[model samples]
Target: MAIVDKSTLLVLGPAAWILLAALLVLAAAVWRLALEGSPAQMLVAGLRALVQLAAVALVIAFLANRGAWAFAFVGLMFVVAVWTSGHRVAPSGRWWMAAVPLAAGVVPVAALMFAAGVLPFNALAIIAVVGQQIGGAMSTVTLGGRRVRDELAVRRGEVEAAVALGFQWPAARLMVGRPVAGEAVLPSIDQTRTAGLVTLPGAFVGMILGGATPLDAGLIQLLVLISLLLVNSTAAAATLWLACRGAWVREPA
Candidate 1:
């Protein structure tokens, strides 16, 4: 089947409520931006995202009964994730190299979880871990990529000055790169530091809802926190290396 299918909702039941909520959000975003500007694209994108999610939910509902389907779905998700990260990072052929960070960061953690039996190799467990991996990678990629690009734009002269002073590309970029990449980690760090105090993470609430004890929920949340750190760390490191190599080099203004 084509990636996107033509589908419609007649706006009834819970879907009607959801559509109302979505329209509200669209109106809010447009109003925030000043309705002098068109939000047609934004509305379309929002609708697309909602439909895509609905389709995925339907697919997962079926996958719950088939382990292979779940695995395949996870694989497809990773592929789409890499495509998205690459597009945002470097809209060029070289972006394909993002496969390294995308896979390297997520796969090992997943492998370790399965090997150590920390995560069962079942449909639900795989889905959960894979979801976490994709989310972590997405965060890292967006942070690392956007920061590097923005820093380069703001500090191109600094980069050139360093290069003129005999610094190699990597060393020259380090002045802006290190700090930006470091900042990229702030969200994850803040989330970790304030996990329970500021926000109850999904894992904890999910475990509780699933009838697990609070102790079990706490342990699972802790494990998830650690796992996300590893995944993001690896992705950021890989992204930094790619940036240093000028894989995402800035174009002249």
Candidate 2:
């Protein structure tokens, strides 16, 4: 099968249009059944994703030739990931605290990959690996942060009681928030366990489609999944810590 040809482009063209139409229909259904504001939100998210991806494609084309520019691009991606996760979790003051968890998860693994020569010092390779790791960390951080905040709010009395029993405020909050915060990483765990059985992940499928052997694709996919586990676990733990430390505690209404 020819990988890069007119037929591939033809298929992608229709697929994109069909996806857009489906999104519109789904947005309409959501608006009619749920919040009236959701349709606009959905449309906006879709449009923004399209624009962002186009822009990234252009940027990647330019950056692929320059090692320094590629590193800078990755840095920009990290910053955006931090801002996005922070906004999703906190949406108000001190949302920047999200940077801690994102960095905590991404930096160590990235460093180790470089040191082990698993990640080549090349533009495309660095972008692909680091981008996925950053994205995974961002998702886990946001999930853990939001869950901890909600848990803290619901279990405020328990936290107070712990404080009353001489636990520090942070410790009290951690005690209340830890259980649910860990739930953020459960998806990663489940996906890793069920990868080839229940679902073929994109990385594996893409590699196979690009003519890689099944064994090679499977190995790469395993590496990606294991890397995600490390990233999400660290990020979730950090997010919980930040939440317990009152990084974005809401004021009583």
Candidate 3:
């Protein structure tokens, strides 16, 4: 039976659940032993994944074939992305400013895809496409923004030294933090570079299982990867720009 068949999920149902639990236990064990991390955190994350996916699946059931309502759902997803990424960057309630860089990454690519007729306006396609892009943007924003915050915090003296030497704080902060912020895109870069060699990404594997030809799967995966690269790099840069402009500064004046 095809892995992507609708009934396959039901067939594999209990087995899949058990497999996921086993994997979670292994991860939790590794976390506890290798990193001295809390096993509870790992297990909790697994549980959250189960619950959240179930909830999302339920929502998608209703959202199916609901043309413009999909956009509304995307808006909801964007808000969650912004909030989560913002909190990740700074937990001190400056989270709202995350919208700027997040938008910088997600919107242009989405608009381009829709306008170019590359992506259908259907609920499934729109949600899948924009959801992944938004996820990419969120991760990059969190990484870049947090790097800027933490780097500026620890390297406050460098910022001060630059400021003392006739440079402005913003410029000095940028000089110190931009490099770290720039590193945020390295993950996406490496993922793109190593795709098919190091790992079959979910999109590629899923499409293949869904009966798409290998070439078609590869092309779609390439498109997804390329789009993520654009969104992530742009988000990282925009995060840096926002940080330099003082969206978040862990260093005191």
**C-alpha lDDT of all candidate models, in order:** 0.79, 0.86, 0.88
Please identify which of the two predictions, 2 or 3, would achieve the higher TM-score against the true structure: 2
Report the C-alpha lDDT of model 2 over 1-253, residue by residue, as the tens digit.
3234542323455666787879777986788677756666677777888899999999888878676677899999999998998898888767788889999999999998899888887887788889999999998988888888888989999999999999999999988898898899999999999999999898888788788999999998998899999999999998988887887755567
TM-score of each: 0.83, 0.90, 0.89
Which of candidates 1 and 3 is the stronger one according to TM-score? 3
Which regions in candidate 2 have their CA more than 4 angstroms from the true location?
A: 1-10, 14-19, 35-37, 249-253
Instruction: Point to the candidate with the largest TM-score.
Output: 2
Candidate achieving higher lDDT, 1 or 3: 3
For model 2, where is the 10-residue window of minimal lDDT? 1-10
Q: Which portions of model 3 miss their true places by more than 4 Å?
A: 1-13, 249-253
Model 1 lDDT per residue over 1-41, tens place: 12332232132466666667778677858755876655666
For model 3, the local distance difference test gives: 0.88
Q: What would the C-alpha RMSD of candidate 1 be, to one decimal place?
A: 6.5
Q: Using lDDT as the measure, name the better of candidate 1 and candidate 2.
A: 2
Which candidate has the highest lDDT of all? Answer: 3
